[model samples]
Target: MTLDFSWAGEKGCVSLFPNPEFHLENVPAGAKSVSLTLTQGVREMGGEELPLPRNGILPAGTFRTFAPCNPGVYQWTAQAKSATGEVLSEARKARYYPSDEVAEHKP
Candidate 1:
């Protein structure tokens, strides 16, 4: 299983908002649903978590686009699970920086 995604037009100089899009590819046959999480740093920023997909669960094989997030380095995760909440497969990516100089970013 594979998950592809991108954060659309996120720039602090222009805007602090992010519009993220997702594309699911080769989902496992045993998977019943998928959940996507985008975390800003280790803790919720500005008193809130990044907005998640409605209900937090998407049907398998869903190709969704257009979600909002804050501009910063983040930890992104996508999980595939069975009906009983058992994880079938999981994908993780780290060291995501919205800015080119994210290492020195303050927000």
Candidate 2:
């Protein structure tokens, strides 16, 4: 699975404000639910779990929004679990900068 960040740049840089919507891709079949977790350093920022559709499939364009409290590198984890106890997970890292920091680096 892959994590899509709505506010991320090409190099995995994110902005501090407006937060970001996280999207999943390549979710496996038979997934009953999915969960998203965000962390910075050793602190967990936020997390949520969403049940899949009645067909046991994730809907197209389904997404979760997470708020970052500070500017730094964040780790994201997405996990999908099936009724049979099968789990699929993916992780990614992104650097977040303050709005002013982003503006200063803009080309």
Candidate 3:
């Protein structure tokens, strides 16, 4: 698996085309300084964990990945930088395009 993405941690948000599928094994093995965070907002939105990008990375925070949401506009942010906060000081946005899920009728 090849990691195909421009490491834009110094200018803009990591925006993805309304997608909902990814893999971690595809990320670059040489990845060293990258921070990935996934978040969403909903009416009475709560802690949630939606599908993340393929080989996405995150940091330690009070944020929860257990938020349940419907088909709508969601938001995400990723901060990639150095320890000294030099050279690199930027983030990216994830545009999640949720697909249709078929649920079987329960008797």
Candidate of highest TM-score: 2
lDDT of 2 by residue, 52-82 (tens): 4454344433543344545555665667778
Each prediction's Cα lDDT score?
Answer: 0.47, 0.53, 0.33
Best by lDDT: 2
Error of 1 at 22 (Å): 0.8
The lDDT, on a scale of 0 to 1, for candidate 1 is 0.47
lDDT over C-alpha atoms for residue 88 of model 2? 64
TM-score of each: 0.52, 0.58, 0.33
Q: Candidate 1 clashing pairs?
A: none
For residues 1-107, what per-residue lDDT tens digits would candidate 1 score against the true structure?
55554443443333333324455566666666666664565553221122224333333223322222444566446677777767777665433445423232223
Please give the distance, in angstroms, between residue 64's alpha carbon in candidate 3 and its true position after superposition.
Answer: 8.3
Clashing pairs in 2: none
lDDT of model 2 at position 58: 41
Which stretch of 10 consecutive residues in model 2 shows the poorest summed lDDT?
A: 98-107
Which residue ranges in model 3 land beyond 4 Å of their true spot? 1-31, 42-64, 85-87, 100-107
In model 1, the worst 10-residue window by lDDT is 44-53
Model 1: CA > 4 A from native: 10-19, 44-71, 94-107
